[model samples]
Structures are given as structure tokens and as C-alpha cells.
Target: MTFQYSRSFAHQLDEQDTLKEFRQWFHFPTNAVGEDQLYFCGNSLGLQPRTAKQALDAELEDWAKHGVEGHFHGKNPWFHYHKFLTQHSAEIVGAREHEVVVMNQLTVNLHLLMVSFYRPTASRYKIIMEAGAFPSDMYAIESQVKFHGFEYDKAVIELKPRDGEHTLRNADILDAIEQHKDELALVFFSGVQYYTGQLFNIKQITEKAHSVGAIAGFDLAHAAGMLTYNCTIGM
Candidate 1:
């Protein structure tokens, strides 16, 4: 199949897209001369939603009106603020509502989850992860390993692509899991590589990890809104 390759063709497709109206819900940045710029950085810092200003204004109004009472008396009470996001967030990530929770930033959440999942033992204490993971993930794993009284060099296994290659092969990843099964305590990886844009086979990786008696986890910073997966499944 061939796709039309022209600005007019692209515009025509966009006009017919059912999600086209959603674009107006976000506030896009402008250039130096005040022309609307085409932004594509949603993979990192997403553009602010147009409704955000109204939401923030309402919060400010509540603070001014209720002061100490604002925690429980407002359009959206602060005490249960995160609850409003649970269902929508679960839908976005294809997870059950109970399986998801609104939390702090990505790295902070990773660290929090790691605290519960990354249990390292004297005999089975190794962590397997991609070599070129985001610095935050690498840092989190390194700190966890060190805190567990294990040296980073000995306890962390970084899987790399073959020489002259840019991405990890699925077979290589599975083979590494099997090869290091005995000492593996955790298998952590990214849903999508940050730099290379390679989407890993998450389900397979998770299964491989489980087969080896290891806990499987992923840093979904680059994957959350960009990819879809069935969280009800093992992955």
C-alpha cells in the first residue's frame, strides 16, 4: 500500500481524523515572531492543556475563598484530588483502575516502585536492564543495587546491542535472561528506548523474567501516551 505524500494530502487526512478536535484542547507554543510552532515534544514534556488555566484558576479561587478549609471544601477538594485521575489514567495505560495510582514524577515513581519490587538477596541479587537506558532509570537501579550492599559492577547486568548496531534484538534479550537466570532478581527495562526509538517486546521480556523467577518492571516515560498494551495481561 502507498500513502499520499503531500502537504495537502496530509491536511486532508487530518481534517477527516476523528481526533482532530482534540488538538485545540492543548496550548501550543509560538515562534519568536509569534507564529504558532509545530511542536512534537510530547514524548518528554507535554504541552499544557488549554483547560489547565481554568483548573488552576479555580484552585486559586478556592484557596482564597476557603483558606484552611480548601482541602475538603471546593469544586475539587484537595483531599481526594488524585482519585479524579485514577479512572482516566487507567484507560490511557490500559490498566485496571485498582492497578494504577497517580504519583509523583517519573523518576520518583520508578524509585518508589523499585523499593517494593527490587528485593535483592545474597545469592540471587542481580538486576538486568538495557545498557543505554535513560540516565534517571540507570541512576535509580544503580542506587538500589548499592543500597542493597551490592556493587554496581557485579550486581547490575547491562545488555547491549551487537557492535555497529543501534537497538537490542529480542532474541538477545531473552538469551541474556536465560543465561543469567540463576542470579537474576529483577528485570527492568524501558517500554521504548529513549534515543533509538526502538519499542521493546515488553510481554516477551516479562514472560522471560517470570520464567527465571525474577520480577519484571519497566520505565514507561517514553511509552505511556505513545503506545498501547494490555496491562491486564502479565506485561
Candidate 2:
């Protein structure tokens, strides 16, 4: 689609959107005049879905009736709740269902994953990631390396764009991974850079890390829902 810089153009594009009607499924905040406010804060937290209250109420009623047994007795058992979400969540992230687990929130899950993947040893322990990753990522990586007896400054290789550039180039990322291949334990990156809105090539990054004998992990908070998995992948 050609770019246009007018509200009418935006409206026309919206009109043509196949999923435009899905807007009614969410509860948008209204202004003082009771007009629906223009919203762009979804990256932080999404607008509540229209059926959210009903869903929550059902779970509340189930809890009231089943008590602690709700884990195994409710319509949606709490014990296996993540299993029910696996397929849908996998599709959103373009991953296999078995590879998905819809459990804890981002930071919690990231730390849990680090426990399994960020195994630092005498030789290979460094992590290469974008310089301006989300604060959660920075803190999580920092804490993980520190916990494993590595200095944050020395263990983490933060990649930034070249001078006067806005976003990082794929070549630079791969080169960094190669440059530190011997010391690289993890190539952690954000699927979509939060600040710049630059989408990284996940498949290439994953393959590059694997090629360098490093584990690759991506924080896909902003990518899921906002981005589409249109590229072909090799089996």
C-alpha cells in the first residue's frame, strides 16, 4: 500500500481492513466528552476485551463452587490451564504448539528460561543483545549474569546501530555473534525492538546463533499480535 499522510487515508485503509470489526471486541477508554479515545498504549497493556468480565466472572463462580479443587474440577482446570492456551499462543508467535507454554508473565518466564538456557561456564558465558532492549530485558539479563558470577559490563555485549543510524542492521548483529562465537553462551534479542519498532529477522538470528554454538532467545512481547508470520521457514 502507498503511504498517505491524512486521517481520511487512514480511515479508508481501516475500512478495507478485514479484521476491522474486531475493534468492537475491546473496551476502549472514553474521554471527558464520552468519545472513544485514540489509543496507542497496547505495548504496555491491551484494552480489555468486551467479554473479559464475563470470562472472569465464570472463573470466579467456579472458584466459589469448587474451592481448591478447581484445579482439577472446574470447566477450565487451573492445573492444566496453560495447555488450553498452547495452540492459540503458538500460532500468534509462529511457533509449534509443543514449543509454547502460556504460563507466567514476561519477566518471570524470561528468568525461568534463563535458568535453563543461560548456563555460563569457564569459557563461554557472554550474552549479545540490542543495546536499547526493554528495561525488563536489561535487568533480567543483568541479574542472570550476576547470579552466575559474571560482571554485567563484561558478560553482556550490547549491540547498537552505527553512528547516525536509528536501528541496527542484521549484518552487524550476525557479525557480533560471530566475533564472540567462542565466548557466546546466549544471543538474546527482542523480536521487535520496543523503542525503534524495528522488527528483527528471527529465523536468521536463530540460525546464526545455532551456527555459532550459542543458544538464541527472543522476548516477543511487542511482536506477538502486532506482527505477522509471513516468511517461509525451512524444516
Candidate 3:
């Protein structure tokens, strides 16, 4: 099981991977010269699925045939389109069907969810999050705090790695929550940090946040299909 730095070793591992065949499901990017490019930027946009063309064509055809009636009648009714994705989406995130709702853009959904959960009293108005969070999340938290007449620095606790370190330690995260137990109103974080590719310990973070009477929330933008784990990971 020794790891080697060679093309043959890479091929060997790929040959043994159980998920090897899944790669063909998407069309990888190709350079202008017709060479396939390596892509790892799933944080923002994922590779287009090969079936996307056929799928879009089907929907377009339905729209042309049914017109406005497509909302009520079609291969997949637009009125109940979200329902069609509910079960599978719920299963992927390890949440009950009732707890999951697929709607709105990510930033919009994030802002709405924060508004509902982040009720900040003067006494308990601090939010804890990773320092270099996704830009949308950072802006969302900033606006939420500002909307409530609180300054970003005073209201939000941006957790940073120690000197010379690249990622956060579990103890540091838990300790921060404990330290701000009294003032902590919300523990908001990205499910998988886009910059560092660090998949956090969600369960432990939630437990710590709850032990101190604070609520924990996650924006699983990159984690829904990108995160790879043997079992379910949830709050």
C-alpha cells in the first residue's frame, strides 16, 4: 500500500477506485487544443453533467408543447418541480423531508435562514464563524449584524488559525464557543471551507454551540455533493 509519485501509481489507484465510473457522468473541461484540463473548483461551479443537454431539451420541448399549461401538465410539472427533488436532496444532506426546502438562490436562502435563527439580544449578540468564510456568507453576516444596529467587529467573532497554521484545530473551535458562551447568539459556518477544503466537524460544533445556549447553522453550499464521507455528517 505504499504511495508512489508516478503516473502508473496514479492510474493504479484510479483503476481500483469504486467511484471511477462516475467521472464519465460529467463532461470535463477541455483546453482549446483539445486536451482535458484538471478541474478542482467545485466550490463555485461544478462540471456540467453529460446528460444536461438531453435534460434541458426535454424541458424546452415540454414548454413549447404545453405553454403556460406546463406548470400544471408536463413530464415534470413546474408547480410541483421542487417536490420532485425533495426526497433525494433531503437524503443527501441527512435531513428529514420536512426539514428540507429547495428554493431561492443560496445567498437569499442564507439571509432568510439567518434572519430566522439569529435573533440577537443586546446581551447575547455575538456570532462565531471562520475568518475567511465564503464571501456571500461573510457579507450576509455583516448585513445581519449591521441591520440590527451592531458593528461587524463587535458583533461577530471570526475564528482564525494560530500563528503559522493553515487550518483551525478542533479544540480552538470548541474553546471559542465556550469562551463566548454568554454572548454567543449564533454559530454560523460554511460546511466545507472553499479556500482550505477543510471539512469541519459539524456534530461537535453543534454540540458545543448548544451546550452554551447558542444556535448553530450551516450553509452546505459545497458539501451537498462535494463532501465525501462514509456515513452521514450533520448537525
Candidates ranked, most accurate by lDDT first: 2, 1, 3
Better of 1 and 2 by lDDT: 2
lDDT of 3 by residue, 1-235 (tens): 9999999999999999999998999998898999878887766688999999999998999999999999999898889988988898887887779877788898898788877888999999999999999988899999999999999999999999999999999899999999999999999877788898888888789888989999998878778876555544443
- lDDT per residue for candidate 1 within 3-78, as digits (tens), equals 7898988888898899998999998899999987889787668899999999899999999999979999989888
Count steric clashes of candidate 3. 0
**Native-to-model Cα distance after best TM-score fit, residue 119 in candidate 3, in Å:** 0.8
Q: How would you order the candidates by TM-score, starting with the best?
A: 3, 1, 2
Off by over 4 Å in 1: 1-5, 231-235
What's the distance in Å from true for residue 197, model 1?
A: 2.2
Error of 3 at 6 (Å): 1.4
Candidate 1: Cα lDDT at 65: 99
C-alpha displacement of 118 in model 1, angstroms?
A: 1.1
Please give the CA lDDT of all the candidate structures.
Answer: 0.88, 0.89, 0.87
lDDT of 1: 0.88
